[model samples]
Target: MKPGIRPAHRPVVFRDKAADLASPTRSTMTGDRTVTWEDGTTYPMADVEISSASHPFHTGTARVLDTVGRVERFERRYGRGEAR
Candidate 1:
């Protein structure tokens, strides 16, 4: 590795707004806020809009759209069964 050429990896706190979850991790991102972890160590806090804590996929709250109804509506409007 080149000397002093790579980006610095520092501990940062990633905060999920919706889920109110925060954790410390190594990242190159910078932030103004700071937070202390359970180990009594402080790091720059980065606010994030979404994360696994609040995400629909991880929380099992994902909404499934009904495509069958949409298909029927399209067929009725454009005629799918008849040959054009």
Candidate 2:
């Protein structure tokens, strides 16, 4: 990709419908859906399933699985915990 010959960067908003979040940025993605921003300008909207707003890592809502329990269960069935 050439530096100056790249695709045009236009104002866009990647919207996460599930999280009801919209991030305004510049991108080359175009969509049929248009949205009115706070500035009263309409921009292209790209609907996404997940974003930083709703992601477990960013939102700090991730589930912590119990790996210790699984390990104990495996050792009980295979008799491997004593080898260490």
Judged by whole-model lDDT over C-alpha atoms, candidate 1 comes out at 0.92
lDDT of 2 by residue, 1-84 (tens): 668887888999899987998989999999999999989999999999998888999999999999999999998888885545
**Tens digit of per-residue lDDT, candidate 1, span 3-75:** 9998899999999999999888899999988887898987899999999999999999999999999999999
TM-scores of the models, in the given order?
0.85, 0.77
Cα RMSD to the true fold for all candidates:
2.2, 2.9
How far residue 80's Cα lies from its native spot in candidate 2, in Å, is 2.7
